[model samples]
Target: MAVDKVFDAIVVGAGHNGLAAAVELASRGWKVCVLEAKSTAGGAVNTQELTLPGFRHDVCAMNLSSFAGSPFYARHKDALARHGLAFVPAEHCFASVFRDQSWLGVSADLDTTVQRIRAVSEKDAHAWQAMLADFQIKAPHLFAVLGAPMPSWKLARSAWRSWRELGKEGVAELLQLLLATPRDFLDRHFESESLKAMMAAWGLHVDFAPDTAGGALFPYLESMANQAFGMVIGQGGADTIITAMTGLLQELGGQLQLDAPVCRIEQDKGHAKAVVLADGRRLQARKAIIANLNPQLVFGRLLDAQSVPAKYQKKVDEFRPGLGTMMLHLALDSLPDWTAGAELQRFAYVHLAPDLAMMSRVYAEAASGLLPAEPVLVVGQPTALDPGRAPQGSHVLWVQVRVLPARVCGDALGRIAAGDWSQIKQDYAQRVLDVLEAYAPGLRGKILASLVMSPQDLEQFNPSLIGGDNLSGSHHLDQNFFFRPVASYSRYNTPVKGLYLCGASTWPGAGTGAGSGFMLATMLAA
Candidate 1:
């Protein structure tokens, strides 16, 4: 604690990844300090009473499918659980509602889902089962390839195993799955638009569109994984993970300073040496400096321009944020009386879209910096899974309006003014609600209160969500895996001595999963 002595390490940002890094380092008896710009931690993964008093809504992240399967959670489950983290599971995980009001979704049991597919097409039912079977065979390797640090033995061995398990022909098919568009992938497997639409809805969760290459994996994993393990939400809110992480960090002797934003990373001969705080305080790290930030922030804003290499600076400058999103939180007196039968009330999420074309149209329109005529909506009724989120007999809904422009330039309807999200966000939220009303009649009447967060609002709340991009940066083919940030430092190490990077901007980009964090922690700890 003395000014004369340096700490073992210092972490900037108290997001899940930063917290994970602190936990790993502190557990090894290293003295650690974590600085957070916000008053509290959990950056984008937070919960708040945004709509009304007593109605707790997840600020951004809600689903925990990736977190449930993440290696970080696996190793820290006991500690997290002991610190008051509880997850509620949903058997009927997700569904897609069409214009005709018909819906298709997955169930906890594969046989149950196969039966539902049979109702649409018996051939599609068989194909659905085949995909699940192949996933079971190739899952271990596929997950390894995703979770491990790129260009490492772990990734190399995982791919090799996949090639071995799937014969040459099967491996070729798997490669095609990786490269194909979501529409192409679906068309190759199923005949029913309803079935394809249900799975393709998963692509919108990320920035991927129907025709976007490297998008097939999201829909494939979403459908097959839901059938395998279903979806999970925290008991009370998404911050249950945050609460538990903070407790774990504190217990491991890591100190956290809130509202202490780092002004710059002080470099000594091109080596990361210390951090200068906005308040003019200096914290020196004896061992390493880890930043859980997007590449733009870490290299573009936080470091001296002259200190970074030209190529690295260019790569960071070119880092593209994904399409923006709008979040709608509603406090209702009762659950949505879904027309798809009350069975939908038992599911976790219901997506509002007619088919893959609708999803594509929205993406195209948004990519053009215009609001769409009809945006794909992800309607989450977590109260169906965790009743503790609202007062007794009442419910809360989390709606994500996908494929909005980061910088609005036009409106599909030509009603709203151009490039002014702040000017028309409320009207936009209403349009989204109107879409919801089409699928769930009388949904407008059930609302006691509502909260709308525009893309600008999201970025304002967390500057790291630059331009309202929740995924940190785009996961397109050119910027993913080994090519992420840049191919040179994809292993988490930086050109600066004793500097590392982790978070959604790093490997295993996006999601609440702490892959990059845990991976970097493991490497540094070793």
Candidate 2:
């Protein structure tokens, strides 16, 4: 499609958030155009044949539970379904395998989960049931805070309601849980070390280590929610939501330009007026412009020095990114025959972090720029839930090596020399496979092909994943909520008028939640 000289909004980046904001504006009868540097849409939320022709792999994100339950999806569910969006439900949401060759899995069926917990520890099984019972009362209050815009009147209202319903004691307890570390939270709730290990792995999904404060909330929610509502992956790949959103946008008369990167934001008297493309094409925005990139990229690179204050720019510079990740995609002739049991083959995710102590050690090593001796592996069995991702009778594995340094200094094992990513990625990949092969004995032998995406490769694939921080920015208490990107601009508005920020870098960070995008769109359009 030809570029319009002007539009009501010109969104930079064709990421899910950018597309979402565009779709919302277009639906409100505004002319919008989304510009993406890459030929494809979906930044971290993409799927491709990275390994072999018959094997389809979700490049970064695989779980769609967040997107499925998002307010954006809720509002446009029928429209999305009409655009070919579908999900495959998993009765077995996730599990954790131990060095002892035993495993603990969570099933959608509460009774089944209780049984498994009982097999581990009868006391913990009672504790598991107790947590589930409390979840019914607590989840609504927790979701109220997470689903609202940070530091907004809506958030205040949510707090008021929680106070009214729960009274002083309950609200205080909620605050304590929110501030607790993953290990602290687990220690307070359960007795079994393996059970605690199983839950703490949820922390690493969002850059939380076992000892990181403000990490407990994620593990609590994931455990409770999976037990309550089950889990869902996109029918074919994680990009299903992206495809649906783009379809909906075009259906509403919005324009999306691929291979069009914005080089500069044109400003007039401290007001964003237009954007200059990399190809030297100038296009004007009549009303607003939304940037779905990290704040550093936006404030430091895209905008002129005079456009933003020095203090604000410094804050953007100080906005920290979490530890890096390496993605491994495998095309296997058959799924891993787990030595623990074949029952482990049925679940969606099998985490390989053995205990809380090891989880803490890995995070410390990664933070110090050392490759962990034993990195935490999130082994995803998407093909188990959706066989269409691979050829008939074959399977695909999505392995995420979490909590690694973006820059390598040395190896903790002291075997592989410290070098650039290209020099050591294969050796590192083999180490990851060796860790997995211990649990699934013949894992490496069944591989038809494999693709290793180092942190550098991830950044190369999508610039928004700076340093391969898939969450875009850290989710620590100081960097989260109202402090995201920066404390002053937490509501998505910039110092420059008519310009805004959104995406994983904003409040309610990461995953396929679509919270930040939907929240920003509703605010702007209103």
Candidate 3:
């Protein structure tokens, strides 16, 4: 590649969204170049053997269900599959172990799930069936609202279609459901505290705690979707999709430059022209420059002060990152023998969040800059469904501790005096292990090797995860929907004429859905 090569578009980051955007444009006859700072692509979708060789762990994301069902995958599934993409399905979706040594899990088989629910509350069993039936009617409407561009005509059309299909009364009911908190929503539907806790764990996957408004949607969507579609992970690792996408991009005449860190976006009179690399190499963009980055970096660091408007800069500065998440990857001799039940080993994720009250406490503690005494752990047992992720009989544990402070101030349990993550990550990792040990006895003994990634470590690895917020920015009602990143700039376009933003920071927010990238491509290509 020539030093002064001018492509039709230059993608700033080679995250999944950036790759999706680059591939989409290249397929439409646009010459694209994707520059990634990291040696590897995929960003949060990356997979690495952090624990040991042959023990492949998804460094950030584990589940690929959202990516599998995304519009981008739907459009290019054949190509991706041809490029060595595959998935391993798990019939058992997720489960939660209670302090009472009891657990509740959701399975693809409706009867199996109902039986588990009936063990706790027969009434809740009936409620579970009703919600699944209701989900059939609501999923399409809800997906329409979520799939369309925020604050666009497509979005208005989706709302109108929902009105026509759901009618006035149905639409009113849907609005109430969207505004309700997880606790409130669960209270109306289920009686078993354990059952509610099992479903509510899905909310914490983003930034929503039990009481967070607009939190009900994720719990409802994930629970119902998992029951309907089951869950699927990459065949070997989560990076399969990334590898496939990049391969397809190259085949389509798109260029990917790894370890090419963009220092800043060069602009001329409010028009983004090129990106200057950290090594002082400039690659010009003939038409557009798309930044798949945190909004703060795109505005606060990349674009020069004179190029960005003062008001726009203020909005980016005020953008709130979600509570940080810590990653714990372990190469285990075998899966834990759960005290709740051995059946837990069959599920993809086992959440160690006993109840809604605990969820609320964890959120409050992290929000107050205090290290949570008992952090909610999302224990991902990928080997249960995909043995190829590790050597035969061995397993990899992907434990994500959610809702930790970005910058610690104090310890909720008063056990650790150090506030810095460097000094306290190991101590905090042990606390998470203790939490798991309560549900899965002798869990610690199975560990052959372990790798702990603090919030700081994640941010250093990938800058988009500012403060290690995997969702990139908070998904609260005020910061999400049409108000994401900025109120008026929800459609990927920025104040600069040819510079656009994509990735987790844009509307439709986090997860591996690739909605922001695909949507942005459609707009630009049109």
Candidate 4:
């Protein structure tokens, strides 16, 4: 195909956020074009038949919680709904199983979650309710902070007003909640080790140590609140959200070119001029260029060295990629019979973290480039919530083991590709299966087929996920807010004029596709 005419804007990477930016800009009368390296539009939000002929497995992300609170969902609900988008809430958000065979199920209902806690520790149950109550009081303000760009005058003013409204003591308590680690906070509130472990495991969802600085248990609570309000699965799976965004972009006259890997972002007169595709096609843009990729790939590989500010370059080099994950997608011939429920219950967000000490050890091992002796596994059976995902009477199970170390030192990728999982994947997968078998005994026999995607597979599939670091960048205190991606370019705008970032790598870090697209849209529209 010949190079098209210049577009008002060119979005590199057709991820959800990229498509979102294109849709917003195009809706405002800007001629937009989206370029994707992959064959499909959704970057990580892909669905494929990896397990069986008819089973539709969500390749990467399964939860739509992060995207739920996004402006993309709110502003375009009708369009999304028209594209077959649907959400099914999990009965219990998650269940944490301990080594002693005890478990805690975190329900969607706040009172039910507290009751689950009460089954373990009565005092802790009351404490959980108090925590929820306190957070509810401040949830609106917190949501405002998350919704908008950070370091804004508005955010500061809101913070000041909150301080005044809540009083000095309340402000102090809130600060403590933000700074304390999940383990510390849970230990202080709950006496039972299982209860503490159950709550603390939520912290691991992001790529941070439980004891990492500026770590807090509030992140877990905040995520739960976000889910409670509207964490629905896209009708056909997670990819449905991405498909809706893409459809909207197309409807608004935006163009999308897939299988076009961008090799470099061309610049002229200190401004972004165009992007050079691997096929030697230079697609030019008139107004701006947005990158929906990780900072390392965007700065280190895409942009020329001279175009980036020296300080920003240094920070990009130092910015750590968060945790790595190993995912197992299974196609079961029949549903696993469980005492909890005969039909796969939405309450089956299962966790295999034994205790706080064990969870801590898991992180320590992952950081040291060694697989955890006993890893934590999180499982979700979306097929239970939506049966259309698989063949009749069959099911699909999505299992993920977070905080796995990227086998960087050795030829781990080669070994894994060669079917040798370095004993890590083997041991971890078996452990997860053992947990499943015990809870749902016939689960092992019901497995018709399974596919495992190592961290290497993630990187290969989406180069933006450097070393399988899904968050784009770490969510550590040093890398968040003003320091996100880099301090000088925190507002989605880069030092290179007219070039902006619209991906998970920007502020708010990962999981939620909140910051990049909306921030870029607001800035460009202004």
TM-score per candidate, chains pooled:
0.97, 0.98, 0.98, 0.92
Error of 4 at 442 (Å): 4.3
All candidates in order of lDDT, best leading: 3, 2, 1, 4
Off by over 4 Å in 1: 1-5
- lDDT digits (tens) for residues 1-526 of candidate 2: 2333999999998888888788888989999999999899998999999998978999999999988988888988999899999999999999999999999989999999999999889999999998988888988898889888888899999999999999999899899999999988899889999999999999999999998999999999999999999999999999999899999999999999999988999888989998999888888998999999988889879997656898898898898999999999999999999999999999999999999889999999999999999999999999999999999999999999998999999999998889888789999999999999999998989999999999989989988888888989999999998898799789988899999999999988888888888888888888
User: How many pairs in model 1 have backbone atoms within 3 A of each other, for residues 3 or more apart or on separate chains, i.e. clashes?
Assistant: 0
Q: What is the C-alpha lDDT of each candidate?
A: 0.87, 0.91, 0.92, 0.75
Query: Residue by residue across 409-472, what tens digits does model 3's lDDT show?
Result: 9999998885788899999999999998888889899999999999999999888898989999
225-306, model 4: which lDDT tens digit per residue? Answer: 7335534565667888877778878888889999998898888888998888998888888999999888778887898666
Single out the weakest 10-residue window by summed lDDT for candidate 4.
410-419
Q: In model 3, which residue pairs have backbone atoms overlapping below 3 Å?
A: none
Deviation from native of the Cα of residue 124 in model 4, angstroms: 2.1
- Model 1 Cα shift for residue 60 (angstroms): 0.7
Of candidate 3, the 10-residue stretch with the lowest lDDT total is 299-308
